[model samples]
Target: MRAALGLYLELHAHPELSGAETGTAERFAGHLEGDGATVTRGIGGHGVVGVLRNGPGPTLLVRAELDALPITERTGLAYASTVPGTMHACGHDLHLASAAGAFALLAAEPDTWNGTLLVVGQPAEETLEGADAMLADGLYERFGTPDTVLAQHTAPLPAGTLAHGRGPMMAASAALDVVIHGRGGHAGTPQLTVDPVVTAAATVMRLQTVVSRETAPSDQVVLTVGSLRAGSRGNVVPDEAELSITVRAATDQALERAVEAATRIVRAECAASGCPEDPDVTLVSRSPALLPDPAATAAVRAAHEREFGRHRVLDWPGSMATEDFPRFAVGGVRTAYWMVGTTSPRQWRAAHSAARPVPPNHSAEFAPDVRTALPAGIAAMATAVRQLFKETW
Candidate 1:
């Protein structure tokens, strides 16, 4: 517990952005090497991989992210982020520390299980590009293919609770950047030019109907415009307005329908406003929905019940939150990812009693109660991995 807490504090103090996690990678590599594992760095843009072989047994892969968000820290903790405009708001620091602790435990008790463990510290998970980059750079080829892949994330549930399900654990996601072009003109003149500001407003309103009217009520879909940029000054109209949107769905077909509907609405709105050209809709950072193998999930869930008891281990529904962890299952390897609660019991009770909202993951005020979460995370992860090995044995 002491070792994991110390590592978590150090990581939280010095948060790094995605694809720029040089120092974070070094720290993870150091921990892995210290545990007598063969370490490799720079796999796919600051990614680190550690391999430990105990005998002729099935290989299991465990992954942890090594990047932070661009938000500033507002938790006011003693070990808050020192880097400006960057924070571990998503609890990747907790993930790293827990994985490191699990690795250390396995190294210390070599006879507990006999299997090759591959620990991956991946970069750029926030942008949803890191997992593919590492795989393209030959992650499996260098480390050998694994029988199962395991990962977990932090959630707002009460600390010491574990959650998982059979299918669609996380949503498939796409990032869309749309540029609406118009002729610049004076704001005072009403009839002088095509007003893209008005067009962008209409586009936003119309997008809300795509999910409500166009798609079936049974299907789950979410389209959010996170960023918008228009004219620089209020007096003069700008030539173009830009919008950043994110789309998510439980299935690929539904995701495609949502994207198509969004593009059509953007183009039709721009055309109706008499713009010079159609709005440009560019899609990037595409990720498939995460569907864990049912058999693998069952085995891991049973392991958790044994380790933490049935009361602490809860059945979870699929979440709309998306991640790049599913990319590692591209080659048909069985994968299972779970979520562990980070909020303390006191905070959870206060939120309900005081009517105060709990700080969710990716919020600036999201400071995980590491005192309780870290130990549970380590135990749950290590127990799951050991269960996989025991089944193979």
Candidate 2:
């Protein structure tokens, strides 16, 4: 556990942003090979797959994300981020370390399970494009698709608790970028300009209605305008304004309706405000929602109860967070996404600041209490892998 913590901290100190995780992938590959697993590098940009086969019955794949956020570091720790503009604000460092630790434990005790293990270091999860790239590059066909897929994400729950949900563990996420165009002029002579800033603001307010009035109350839809940019000066009216949005929904139908409603609102608002021709609403990227398999959840729950006792495993609500791991479900494989808690009371208090907002996963100040979280994560993944292989084949 100390060795795992040391490795995790080292990864936390030297963080890499999405799509630029060359060094991180190489280091993980080295560790995997050191543990007697056959390591494959450069699968999907910077993905590393470690194979450990022992007279396989069914192949079990365990995945861990390996990219950090683009926020500047402010943690002020001794092993702080060396990179200026990137940090492991999302606990991917712990995810990588825990997966490696689980691989180590399983490699040492291969006789405990009777199948192959594929521990994968996936990249570009922050951008939600890595898994697609891996699959396109033959992740499944090249290395024999697994019978079941297992992955875990750390959360803000208690230090040593494991949380699991049966179905719809995470919502699907789509990045919506709306560009509102209009004529520009001086702020004082507002009659001459169309003022896209006002139109953009109105559109932002109207977007809120998509989830509230458009979707059903139980649909679980989230439409957030994360960023809005328009004017550069107080006196001058900008020609165009842009809004970056994140749309989430529990089901695909709800997601489609949200997108359609948002597009209609943007068009209607631009026309009603008498702006230029029309507003451009485009989807930047998208990831499908993760729906957990009942059998997989039951297997994980039983395994958690056996390994950490029934008291440690707890029922959890579905998270609004998005994951691309659901793509694996397309080929008829069961998936389980677990939440490992990383927050402490001190950390929670620090997170309440309005100025800093307690540094969530994408913030540079976001850091996990690895010493308490890594072991449980490792144990959970290992137990899931063992149980999944044993029950299926």
The model with the greatest lDDT is 1
Candidate 1's C-alpha runs over 4 A off are none
Using Cα atoms with residue i matched to residue i, what is each candidate's TM-score against the true structure?
0.98, 0.94
Shift of residue 235 alpha carbon in model 2, Å: 2.5
Put down candidate 1 lDDT per residue, 1-393, tens digits, no spaces: 677788899999999999999999999899889888899999999999999999888999999999999998999899999999999999899999999999999989989889899999999999999999999999999999888999999999889899987679889999999999988899899588888889999999999988999889999999999988998898998889999999999998899999999999999999999999888889878999999988889999999999999999987788889999999886678898899999988778878898988899999999788988999999999999999999766
lDDT of 2 by residue, 1-393 (tens): 666677787888888988999988987888889889999988889999999999948998999988988888887888889888888888889889999999999988978988888999999998898998898889999898988888998877766779888678889889988889999999999999999999998999998999889999979999999999998999999999999999899887889889889889999999998987788888888988888888888988899989988887887788788878888775788887788877766786666654445555666566676767888888988888889988889
Clashing pairs in 2: 351-358
The whole-model lDDT of each prediction reads: 0.92, 0.86
Model 2 residue 323 distance off true place after TM-score fit, in angstroms: 1.7
